[model samples]
Target: MTGTQPFVLAEQALLGALLLEPSRIDSVRPHLRPHHMYRPAHAALYRALLDRPPDPGLTMADRTMALVRDAGAHAAGITPVYAHTLMAACPRPRHALVYARMIVEAADHRLVREHAVRLGQVAAADHARDGLADTLTHHRHLHRVLDDLHRRRPDHDTATSTPAVPTPELNPEPPLPGNLDDEQALIGALILDPAPMSALSRWLTPADFADTAHATLYRCVHALVLRGEPVDSLTLAWEAQHQGAFAAGDGGLTPELVAHIATSGMPADVDYRARRVLRAYVLRTAASAAAAVGTHAGDPTLSTSRLVTAARTALTPLDDALARRHNAITATKAPFTHTPPTTTATPWCTGVATWPTTGPDPTNPTAAHGPRSGRRP
Candidate 1:
């Protein structure tokens, strides 16, 4: 409700910050200070030099001079760019970020949406996992709330497609995970589900893989692949992820793989370098398969291009995206991490836990041990 709350909300830490201290907004003032703009010439001149890259040698006077030059075009035109510039140079990092965000929020409605789009873009040069996570988290929650509202009552008279819900289920668990080889093994299972994949609608139950979530996730992914439904794997992955079922011990690669399969139509949310490598590999593997098949028959529709294209085309773009995403993940880190951060919510923290001594060992009933320390919860 306060001026600073929007930035807090935009940052996804608003609730947590509010819980910590109700006046977190007071901290944001330095960065988001606004230009008065009533003095158009001075404001326009100031903004022009601020928006573009500044020469290190340029004094404030020189910068102002540049601003004066640009304003021949009426620098303080009140256009989206002008507003964007004003906010971007708020003279404080935090305040500037807030103003930039506010500009984007406002631009979302007007003809100059490009201004908003550019403001929101996470450039490869600027992308920090932390910042991306922060920004995306806020937008994601907003999207979730709006979607819930939209679904309550559809406009039956309208011809547009239903709001893009991204998935069918809420709080879907992630696939069980494993190492890279484990991922491959899980894929193999889907191709050959020993229990018969068709029985998912009737027999598959969460409890079946209670002790081995990774296996359960694989089975679930196999089921979706079998159905060949049109949906996003990432969305389904969220279900598993939200339930803390994504990591290896929880559920593992299976849910992630499943998410990849479901999201065949989109890019794999992977970092570009990692994705390219995967795309190249997929292309190469597909080419090799086509070449081998040509030996068996007079090229029975098995050109290298056609084969690779067919394989990629067979699944939605999201499949390649998942592969690409997995590639991104593995590029920097190991195939499987020890545990996800959320796993700490459990009572146990150590991997090799020792059992409590059973009443000082029954065999030595009188073996007195002095003042034992209590086990802290």
Candidate 2:
């Protein structure tokens, strides 16, 4: 709550600045709106500013009083006098955009924080229930909420004039249940000791992470490992900051989080941890593919063959992984050698003579020739 106090001041300043200089509303309008303000009174004032005519002939004070009166702010316990107080308190009208931006950022933070709290509640409930089906459902809902919160909003200026476009719904399948503690332990271990990077890289990558912050952190760590650079808390934090991963006001890669992960679990079984991460990723992908197939299976436009093909493609990753493992095992086994027979066998032959026949054997005295005699000829 204390952190949000500045946004309250910013909202006041923005409304005040706009009221003092109505012309500046155009610049602030693209970045903010009435709902962006934390306080309802400030929000109402912003709406008033936006509702005013472009060339109102009335003085600013008179316009504010008329708007407040029309809005029945008196009955709502807000008055025109408060409006005048805000207008007089604005330090500079030129900084309206800055104040508007602050309000917008605060609104975004509020949304994220509210959703996070709800997510925590749902997760706790699901844990208490301890049902696999319920857990999966809760996780899917959480993913949807996370996706919505992180999805980029269209620019206010262009969004007003542009035609609405439909976007395909994202896959509804939730990621497979994973041991995040194990994942964190592996990553922390890798950072604590880069010697395992080469071995672990074969089984896991940054994309294997289900959490965005962890993914970003892992990517930084992967980069450092590839470059032969040290990867500890300090280096990881520096890299994350440099990459702007922590610029957004959400959970991000930080030294404290890293240290906590490092100490949370044993880092010695990193190879096994990497396998678990990879397995979770594979299962998640498979589930997504299955869900996609199920969704598209009933569509009249799609052929059964296409659905089958898609299903197969979706399930191919596991098959490929298994195949690779089999090949690796085959490669490590002993080579086979063939041995020749000790003795040669008789050659195969048809029962026929290889001599030319000239009607009959003329030199033989008792020789019967041609078709009349079935002799040696």
The residue ranges of model 2 lying beyond 4 angstroms of the native Cα positions read 1-4, 73-75, 131-377
The whole-model lDDT of each prediction reads: 0.33, 0.55
Best by TM-score: 2
Give candidate 1 misplaced runs (Cα > 4 Å): 1-132, 138-186, 189-377
lDDT for model 1: 0.33
Assess candidate 2 and give its lDDT.
Answer: 0.55
Spell out the clash pairs found in candidate 2. Answer: none
lDDT of 1 by residue, 32-95 (tens): 2225222444344434434444455766445434544575466444443443344343344434
